[model samples]
Target: MSELDDPVGSSLHGPHAALARRVGRTATYPADVATFCAVPADPAPQDWADLARLVGPGGLADLFTAPGTPPPDWTPEFAMPGRQLVAPVPTGDVDPRVVELGRDDDPAMLQLATATRPGPFFARTARLGTFLGVRDGGELLAMAGQRLHPGGWVEISAVCTAERARGQGLAAVLVAAQVARTAADGGRAFLHVVDTNAGARALYARLGFTQRRPVLFRGFRVPG
Candidate 1:
């Protein structure tokens, strides 16, 4: 299978290896970094067994885009239809207002993501890759950053602007900055958007991203 088809697995096995925790053939990011788990594309019983043990009883098995259904006892948490889009790096200068965020910016980053509900951002999610933000004075107004690194591609995620800051094109600026950064590292950029978010889909299209495939973002609770 293409690495993109099993991005979580490919990331754990490739670029994000050091950040992974493995239990037999299953792997997952740390709880504070991300909740994503990776199982074999065509999961066998043992693969499910490994995932159960890795997350422990009652823990969430956030199977981000992997198709295998868990055992009958696993309770569904959520299932969202999303599309993966890919784009060539755009040639442009990053907005002068954009700044690279560092460890000190974690609290603000987490707060903004929580308020914006952009995606599954966590306390240490910034460790996944470079994060950039736009701040107005001391207040953070918008942000975007990289997440999964599957072979030659980087997943741009958590692209969001504050409620009061929308319509200023901050989301577009932040996304473009993220794409530029990925290009600097010799990787192309891609992102996942909920299929129902027509506005986001249109924005990405304007930035030159085209749908690569539909994906499902799923999470389930491990049976106790």
Candidate 2:
């Protein structure tokens, strides 16, 4: 076995797997505690093989890992180099544009997400955690919210602004608010971004989010 195949991806496993086991409702192949089937982070060779089989060839599976290197077999359609950034809660009031988003806001959220393509926003994705958004008049224009909860870390995900809403600083405010929320909880705020999105990476840096480590956003094919 190659060194890359060693059982190394463990940051999001162990106790964190319990979250996927408990709330990864979309999980299919194995919903049991020992083998949740949403997205596997840093899986072992046997476990990785099992998940790939579960996804099937030509199908897709997402894997998140702390950056170093990856095995050749687990190729992704898109690979994003991610950073786990933490910030201090704002010393002043949170951005008022950041509005609390809940289940009732699903219609607008889904619509905006579909147009912006900020990763997967499932029908029941609002159940993940607290989500916030900014609306123009009545239309949802910008949004950001939580995704994964590994240990005390809450991932801020689905951050996007409508094309028409760009340059109004909506995305920045929304992200800052989310980080503030996460910080208030005594947990750190983290996010995954495509390495190619230098603009977004720069914005995160301006917000005092220092790079903790590199993580990979992988998408693999599951055969039909």
Candidate 3:
């Protein structure tokens, strides 16, 4: 429960430790790597200060559902109601069409993510974990991959399908592949979706993912 309670923090302290930038107990990834910042579950004032220092003045503190309020000087950025979904161990083989992405694919990956606005992606994001994609010849049609690794759970993130590829079940195929990979790695699968995205929620439900808990996707601008 604690891991899920502070997913970004737990991930910074765990599998993604190498990518973390720390100042006291607060931590975050490099801006290009991710905008996520992690504060302790019951964050104190000093923890906020530590986070401010880590992200620097005027930077975004994208605390991905960590608990605590930023000080008065920190301006609110955006807050969206979201929910976490967990999936049972998958039961099928990855589709042969699914391909593992690598460094050489950075440009195409970034292009596809930018066009689809899946989430925060950067040149090095693929380093976070395994990313699987479906391509139609030279163009990437859809993709999904591992993001946060909190405790024994893996967060499937950045799922998106090109407009031309929509309605072809590419998103479902990629998600299924990610879930199967999560199970193969001895981990559980989970994800977060904004409450307004009814379509995505329904899709996840159809894929056997159940709502685990409600979450708030929040961010703040560090005081200058």
Candidate 2 residue lDDT tens string, 61-175: 5544422222465555776665555555555568877899877798888788789887767665655678999987888899998866656677787888999989888988998
**lDDT of candidates 1 onward, in order:** 0.91, 0.63, 0.88
Error of 1 at 106 (Å): 0.4
TM-score of 1: 0.97
Show where candidate 2 strays beyond 4 Å.
1-45, 66-76
Clashes of each: 0, 11, 0
The number of residue pairs in model 3 that clash at the backbone is 0
Please give the TM-score that candidate 2 achieves against the real structure.
0.74
Clashing pairs in 1: none
Q: Clash number for model 2?
A: 11
lDDT of 3 by residue, 2-36 (tens): 68878888889998998899999989998888889
State the local distance difference test value for candidate 2: 0.63
**Candidate 3, residue 72: how far the Cα is off, in Å:** 1.3
